[model samples]
Target: MDLKEQYEKLLRYCYMLTKDVNLAEDIVQETYLRFWQSHTYKDTNKELAYLYTIARNLCMDEFRKPKLDDIEDYCELSGESEYEPEARIDSLVIEEALEQIPKDLRELIVLRFTNEMSVTDIAKIVGISRFAVHRRLKEGLMLLRRNIGGEAND
Candidate 1:
């Protein structure tokens, strides 16, 4: 797969980590820059995993800094009439539900579902075992389903 194709997925992963779109975009750009600069891309077969690892590390480093406040800016979707109503509504619901989950679970869920990454790849990116990834994915999906379902019942 083309590294460029991973841009949106990587951005989503970073956004999940930082909860800030601008910061996530910066992390994604820095990830690609560092990935190219390190030249590890030439040796590593898991390009996506490597990029994700870089972005995750950057997000961790950002968290270590003392920031005044975390501005929560969800719903970055544009209010355009071009998008289908159902799709837009579903997107918002899913985004809202995802925000309610634990950060660890949320990141795993995004990597697995949004990025369409395998359990092994996710484990490598997350530095956890495949078994742990599976367990967390199951738990996260259950929570996500409950959250989405609760919204429907409301």
Candidate 2:
């Protein structure tokens, strides 16, 4: 894989971490910088996974800072109404519900759905077992569904 492919994969992973396009781009850029400096591109196949790990760590570090209010303000200023009103409302509700989830579960949902990573890959990235990834994905989805006022059959 070339740099462009690496970047695209990294961008998707970063977007999963941040859920904001601009922030995702920024994280991808930072991932490239660290990757280049670390000289971890000898094997192109590993590049995507390596970049994801870097981006994930960076996003976790960012989350560690006490900036919940800042994130809320940013989300508000982005204007939820700019999109279709009904969809926007639903999105806001879902996002708010996601915020209530613990970071571990939320990360699982983002990795599974937003990044479209396989359970094996997510387990490798997160240093967990494949079974654990599946459990987390199932539980996270159920939590999200419940929080968003959707019925959970199981």
Candidate with maximal lDDT = 1
Q: For residues 1-154, what per-residue lDDT tens digits would candidate 2 score against the true structure?
A: 5678657767766655666667777888987788789775675455455667778888888778786577778667544433422347666776678777888999888777865777877887798999999998899988887877742232
Expressed as tens digits, the lDDT of each residue in 46-90 for candidate 1 is: 566777898899999998888655333223332222433344777
Give per-model TM-scores: 0.83, 0.64
Candidate 2 yields a Cα-based lDDT of 0.73
Per-residue lDDT for 63 in model 2?
A: 71
Per-candidate Cα lDDT values, in order, are: 0.81, 0.73
Candidate 1 matches the true fold with a TM-score of 0.83
lDDT, candidate 2, residue 109?
87
Worst 10 residues of 2 by lDDT: 78-87
- Candidate 1: regions farther than 4 A off: 40-45, 69-87
